[model samples]
Target: MPAVDWRVTRLSRRRSTVTRAQVETVTGRALGLFGLVFGAQTVPIALVQADALLPGAGAALMAVLYGAIVGLAVATVTKVAVRTACLAFALLYALALVAWPFLVDDPAALHGAAPWLYYLCTVATTAAVVAVLPVWAAAYTIVVPAVYGVIRLLPSGGDAGPLLAVLDALYAVVLGVVVLVIVTMLRQTAGAVDAAQEAALERYDVAARLHANEIERVKVDALVHDSVLTTLLSAAAASTPEQQQLAARMARDAVQRLDEAGATGPRALDRVGLPVLVRRLRAALTTFTTPFTVRVVNAGGVELPVEAVEALYAAAVQAMVNSLQHADEPGLSTRRELRIRGVRAGGCVIEIADNGRGFAMDRVPAERLGLRVSIEERMANAGGMAHIESRIGHGTTVTVAWPQGAGGAA
Candidate 1:
């Protein structure tokens, strides 16, 4: 059968279905757009308040402010350096507010309904929601507005009434807090969804494996009854030379059939070049369901167990299946790597590793033959050793080495 060519193959990026990741991404973009709204109002406000500023110092500030706004706008779509852009915009806004008294040419000339910086507090506070922790977000919402409220009482701030100044400060804090609460709550809910989905997937994997085992068991039982038992009964009933000869031929044919059904025997095959094994292994990797970042290093010079390459390939496939089923860690992006290398002295090593939630060897149930018979035993039976190493939070690495403990990795 031909391997299915999935739309999302090895070359395609891993598209995460995890809700928490999606929520964070969409929220970041939303904040960017919100920043643009406040950013648009900045130009007119700056123009109206220009006469109140010191021409030289204020012109430089205006240039920096414009650059920061442009950065904030770009961060909306690209999502690259989003945190950096948000911090840059917020810091610039605070700096401008702090220097407002010195920047002004005269106190009365600064008269306006609201200071130029007031329009941008929404942008800064919203930006804080995405890039900062809850405590820092709270500080940004309160401290930035409080600074403006203090300035609102001074002549340089246009000397607004006490009631209006307090209200404006209160308004900024309320808006910031509301945004913070919404995002935080949504993130928590999404995280719970992700955990539940992973648990369901794990259960599905277990059920699928059990169903496959039952199918294999039925096949083996049929093979024994239809082939081996029939050959034995014929041999026992034989009395004449012709009948005996016929039984001998039937027995030989039945043994060949049993061999095809995976009966192990000491069979020697001519050693082939390492490149041959690599070509075979690489082709096998392409047929796997999960995409792995494959790296072929020093896959030349050495040759391994010739026909036994199939054993290595089978082990590799099993490892890939294990990674696909359970390597996704909550709140962390997953990455898988397949490394194939030819070492000194007719030896090779194949490693399948994942940066995901790992497991302790002692903790895994004994009945899970995936690690025992499929990977470890298969490799060992083929004159290779399979080493599995993992930590709870770190990750997992399965290494298949030929000529067990015999040669240095290339």
Candidate 2:
């Protein structure tokens, strides 16, 4: 035999709960119908049997009123409301059933000589009790019939022996026990089904999150291979003195990349002022071969988390490096600009623009990770975003922004 799939079992249990609830609702309505039919039959019988209609008339009216209320509540109310109404009705009906014999003008009328209508009322009320409160209904079922047996044994009972009374009581008790067991089992089954559904939903959520993290890790690995490793290989193959100097700068860039990777731990990236970060980037740019200008506006006091700062810094540096390597003119002067500004709505914006030859963004090679990984993905991982605009003729512009109150990715 195949091993049981717990997930499938849990899903099946969940579905079964709805079916059980529907069945219980139908059963409650059926009991209501029984009450309505019993009341309709007994009311006229009660009126005809009693000669005077004052206290006796009140009992007949009460039977109709109780039955109507129970029927209406069960038919129209929600599941919870139906249960509440049934419980209330069961308690009141039990009390009335126990007192019914004593309320009559003739105590002998309740003995073996009692009308069929009287016995019918007892059976209907007992059934309603059994339908709603299973445990309490069992006690009521036993108590009600035992009370009738004792009443029949009295001197006023007339012609009723102990054997006949015992038989009548036993019938009611047996029927009640059967109804009680069924209702109890249904309730327990519904509860177990509900619990299984909740467990299944929790497991599904955990699985979905694990799948997403795996996809993200794959993307990060591809990014590292394309950018850092490619730069190291190119730097090792340089021939000219100027090429060697450029390769030394690339080696320093590679070391910075390694430092950023090692600083991925939360403790290493402490919150720092935006102005301090801008000043540091300005100092780093002085070593570059290309002429560059750094500009800061209204960004002196803005604070960002360490991880966000590292991500923004790395993305800005990559954009500058790309401009130096790719954007060049034979005779015309070319310069790159780095602009940092604090947004009034919160967070900060960093823009890197070049007045040099720009390439088509869509035509960039898939293996090239300068814009994809080092700039865009890095910013996204920091809970920020990078936007790049470029045309073959017009210069390239890269804008990186971190939104207000963003916590960098873990």
Candidate 3:
């Protein structure tokens, strides 16, 4: 599988988060609608009162001035459209309703402004503020209409005045209930949406982790199968002459021993000594190649952890392959050599060196997948280090080192 670039992955996740936020912002439809309704209602009141309502200015001057204010309010707060005559007419209608009662100065002119209709409209306006506006805005809207209605109805007090007050209270209660229901439902829906989004993100994270884990397991299995199994199979099928041959016979026996150990090799890390494991590695290397010396200089007197053992083994195998592949053999190239050294200070170090021509470190890119997966990553996971040193004519050395555990006292 191809590796994912972390920077690109992070950027994609960030873009998705931003898109979700924009969707949430647009969900406030009620607020935008209320702004349009209130702003449109301001227009016609300014229009008809333009002529007779000027205090000092002449009718023409007053008309133009009021028209400007209405136009400004409509343009800013409502959706403007040059083609929609119906919307313009609706604005004109609202203006006439608001201005007619004041301009005619007659109780009869208030007939179109039915008390029940006025109650519903004012309550709706108040509820709109409660639903979509800020606390102070809702208060201002409710207070203004309430005060005007009370002053108009109470001063003309009669037996019916109390009935009107009762009706107003009933309307207030109904509006309160409606607003409560609407707000509650909207809040619940918003909460559910947020929860669903959070769940999706969590699932994505889990899926990504699972896929990464499976890929790593596949890689480890492949490495062991290809290197360890191939060598052993050759040894098992060797002929009588090849059996006596050091290189051919050693290759065959290394595989057999490794297979036998494979049954208990893992347990060796937990219970066996580092000295035995290093000796086995040396024997395996000797089995496969002649004129290549395999020696353990120091074992550190410690048994490494399972992770560290696996890392050391893998690094040694890789080093043997490199020696076989690139050793400088002008004629027979029989002078090729390999060594394994173990040390104990704060930690155990497993070093593999070969007599082979090496390339410059910079010749290998950081993204070289084989080296990263095989050597670097394995040691790192075990809290260890894999260090490589080499020059053009000189051989290469690969060292895998990790701190000793409490039980493994080298």
Candidate 4:
């Protein structure tokens, strides 16, 4: 490829990549906001209950410490830094709960016989952290929760104390399992949301590009019609033979320019399904032209590239629009026939053929510019071909062969 072409392709690819990345970044930010909401609720509850959970410290002090840690962990979610911070805090929590019972001579009475709640709390806290933590934090969460629950069940007081502790420890283990299940469900939901958002953004980008392309083509069409065609017409009216010949040449160039304009835009391609799109076009065609029969032979489940689909739809719509606009009769308008089919031999191929009031393909007059932009140019760029079989008074057969996998999905 030439340097200019290569450069253009590279730039286009880079822009697409950047757009997808922006979508992902937006999703990440939304997830972060959600985490903050959860943290705001959970942290306060943990702090208020800390005095009961950790008897040695003042409730305010414990709450503040735990709140600070939770806040720090939330902040680090933008990076993976929060995982280590959370794990370290969990370890500290384990040490404090373990040492609490041994701090006083009458530790059993101070802890109210059963300290199983402390172990369970630790396990739940660790499980919550694991949801937001890095992938590697799994080991610490699984092991620590299991170990603490088991250790907390050991004999401490008489039969009553021991039995209560064992039940509490069992409850904590169950709590940890519940947290793990919730976390997994939330992760799957988040992933599905991300995928849907990505797909939506991709569709939007394709639509914007197609619109911009159409505007550019229209501008080119207007320029040729307003300035160049007018000049050519004026020149052709001059008496001089040389002026007439030159004017004729200029007129031909203008016709070519008009045709070139259509080459700018891609075909219309609807990604969800082609039949759904075709049905819409058929309905729109009904509004303008009657006695127009649309025969869709086959449109199997064939996925096409975005660009190819866009091209196919554009060509088909243009053909139908032309039939509605130009092919009317004085009293009895001609009957138009449209045939659309899809094939997936190598890749998808959508062929749309319309038989309506046709024009003479051989003698395209100096004024006829619609075919230039709508038929010939657009199909060429889409890596497709357009064939028009038309005769005056009879109908025109416009066949558009769309090559799939060339254009991006529209």
Candidate 5:
């Protein structure tokens, strides 16, 4: 097994998190379907008023405008062309609104009814907001409705009085603003969530490194006392040639041990590869008194801090020891599992589960330090967390993860 490096580095990877882009994709799909359905509803209304439009080219123009909107909606939902489709829909709708007067066969054809284009102002605005920047979406939301309001007052338009046109414009603007605000809020919230998740992982990484330093200090101290001091005493007392030769060999071994623990190790922020951690863990598992069914799924290329690795390994061993001491039944055969798997951001999850007589977590006494202090507290100090799940006669599972919150890797 490769030696455990005492030096730990700052975490640079993130656990699985809810990102802004993920929320935006969902928002786009939803708005795309919204545009598609509402845009298609206006089609029957357009067909009914088709005669009022210019002959021959009127229906073709209607199809072109509606086709683009609906097709873009489909593309948006499929995620093949979201922003591009929304941009096309917004631009096409605005141009269509400008050409509405010319498309009419007669200026007075629709004596009182509002034009079909008036109903689609919000849909176009929705597309703009979903695809473009806030400034441009706001511009479209204001300009498109204002243009529609103008068309509503023209002879070629319904020629409705100013009151109704203003009311219609205000309603569209309000609706567009509401949609834009919702999209913006969702995006901001998702971004904050992503940030929080990253910050938490970083904190865990730092804590784990500190704990690793402490553990290493104690081990190095023990090595110096047991090996180096013993060798020095033997050298001082040696008189015979054979005894001196043994003392020289002992001193050499002590030097080699000190070298391994000295300042020549990895830097404080260097990554310990997952493969090395896995190798160490497997070696530790083989030392256990009780055999466990083990499964390993390596997360390729993940490198975590030395402290995180040490913390996870220590927690797993504690959990196994806990199971050996407690999980048992007189007449029942017990089975246990040890699963170590790679998680997001190069961290790992270690699960120790047993199908034996189990005890409730809440009932585990505060005085018992096996689960509370040695296992759970140790992991917490090391920037990881230990989770205990159990019920009487069902089983117990102690799940621990580095970078925090990566319990789902199992």
Candidate 6:
């Protein structure tokens, strides 16, 4: 057999418990009241008919006591407890139904009203059996009446024919079948509902996984365009010995980044600190071909993951290169500034601004991946963001920040 799903099992059990409780609550109250009235009515009748203390009279009284005790006990206990009491009472009542015929000294009493006291208790016991032990209910229903019919046909029993005995027995048996069908239908409906809920939850989990994978794919595409390809192009364009050496160093860094992306080991980014990161970036900037001013403010002791620091450093370098290659004008002096500041909220921001002629943001071609992939998407992939502010005559400012809320330094 296949292993059972614990979720479905739990749901079925919970629903069964609620259904069992409802059955017990309704049956307990109804049966308890019925037993009290039946006992009151029959005790007096038995006393009058027997005219003196007798076994038959005593059995009638015991039936009443059994019914009242079981009924009241079912009302007070939990569903499982009620079920146990119901089964036990059903067995005891069945035995009493069989023995009541033998206990009676008067044969006429069996045919007349005295037998009804036993019949009433038997019917009530059958109902309790139906509520708790649904599978065995039909058997008990048939057996209770069959045993009574057999005794009525015996020599000691009242002069009753076979046909009359069977007809009386069939009435309660039919009622038991109807109760069984209704309970079975309800259980099937509950199972269907639990199955539907489990399927819906599984679908939601699958959809969420697919959406996350799509997002990660977009980030990887942007990183490849921004870092690896850009470094290779710079190496191809180098003319002087110093420029070639710088390009080779950048190429090595780019390859190492790619290797780290594919590695399964623990990430280097998890151990990077802001102070050490800033010192390395400052050293790299000293080799830039174009002269620029660098300033650090409140950046000491701040730290971040390697991914965030790498994004900021790479984007800042691209911004500086853009200024050196594209911002210079023929007849005007230009000033470039790279500022790194640690915010009070516990993350660092790098602003690369140039006081040189700038281009319109909206007019930039889609093929120019320098700004889109290198600066904007790189920061986005690192769980941070980049903003570019520029105008035709004013200047361009590329601001990259890792917000405190985006898993920055603790």
Q: What is the C-alpha lDDT of each candidate?
A: 0.74, 0.62, 0.47, 0.53, 0.78, 0.63
Query: Would you estimate the TM-scores of all the predictions?
Result: 0.57, 0.45, 0.32, 0.39, 0.55, 0.40
At residue 75, what lDDT does model 5 achieve? 75
CA RMSD of all predictions: 13.6, 25.4, 26.4, 20.4, 17.7, 29.1
Which 10 successive residues of model 2 have the least lDDT summed? Answer: 264-273
Order the candidates by TM-score, highest first — what do you get?
1, 5, 2, 6, 4, 3
**Top-lDDT candidate index:** 5
* lDDT of each residue in 1-410, candidate 5, tens digit only: 32333322223332344456567678778777777777678888787667788786568867877788777768766666677788898898898889888888765557678888877777888889888998899999999999999988887788889999999989999999998898888888886875565455446556655656777788888998999999999999999999999999999999999987774432244455565555556667778777887666665566777667777777788888889888988887889998877876577888899999999788878899888888788777766788889999899999988877774633
Q: Per-residue lDDT of 1-410 in model 2, one digit per residue for the tens? A: 22224543453344223334444666676666666676667666556545422365556646655564555455433333455466556555556545555555554444445433334534444455534556566677677667666655653333368887677667766776666666667766754664454354445435534554565556456546865676677677878888888878777776776666555522221244565457557756988976677666666447665566677888998999998888887786776899887765247788899877888888999899999999988888787889888877678898888862322311
Q: After superposition, how far is residue 373 of candidate 6 from its true place, in Å?
A: 42
Q: Please give the ranking of all candidate structures by lDDT, highest first, separated by commas.
A: 5, 1, 6, 2, 4, 3
Cα lDDT tens digits, model 1, 1-410, are 21212321321233334466568668878877766776676777777678778877656777787778778778767756777788888888888889888888866666655777788787788777777887898888899999999988888887888998899899988887898899889888987876665454345334444554665567678978987888889889999999999889988887787777665433333344455455455556677666677666666456555434556777877888898888897687888998887787477888899988999999989999999999999987887788899887788998887877645521
Q: Which runs in model 5 stand beyond 4 Å of their true positions?
A: 1-19, 59-63, 78-81, 107-111, 228-410
Indicate the residue-level lDDT of 346 in model 4: 21
Clashing pairs in 1: none
Question: Model 6 scores what on Cα lDDT?
Answer: 0.63
Q: For residues 1-410, write the lDDT of model 6, one tens digit per residue.
A: 32224443443344222232234355555555555566566665555545232555555656555554556555434333444455556666666667665566666544443354444644454455544656567666667767767765654345567887676667656665665566556555644544454354335334434554565566667768988788888889999999899899988888887777655222221223354456556657778877767666665446565556667888888888888888888999899888887876358888889988998999999999999999888887777888889898888888888862333322
List model 3 lDDT by residue over 316-347, tens digit each: 67766665666565664434444444555224
| Reference-based lDDT, residue 145, model 1 | 93
The residue-level lDDT of candidate 1 at 399 comes to 86
Model 6 misses residue 268 by how many Å?
30
Q: What lDDT would candidate 4 get against the real structure?
A: 0.53
Candidate 6: stretches off by over 4 Å: 1-77, 109-111, 121-135, 154-158, 205-410
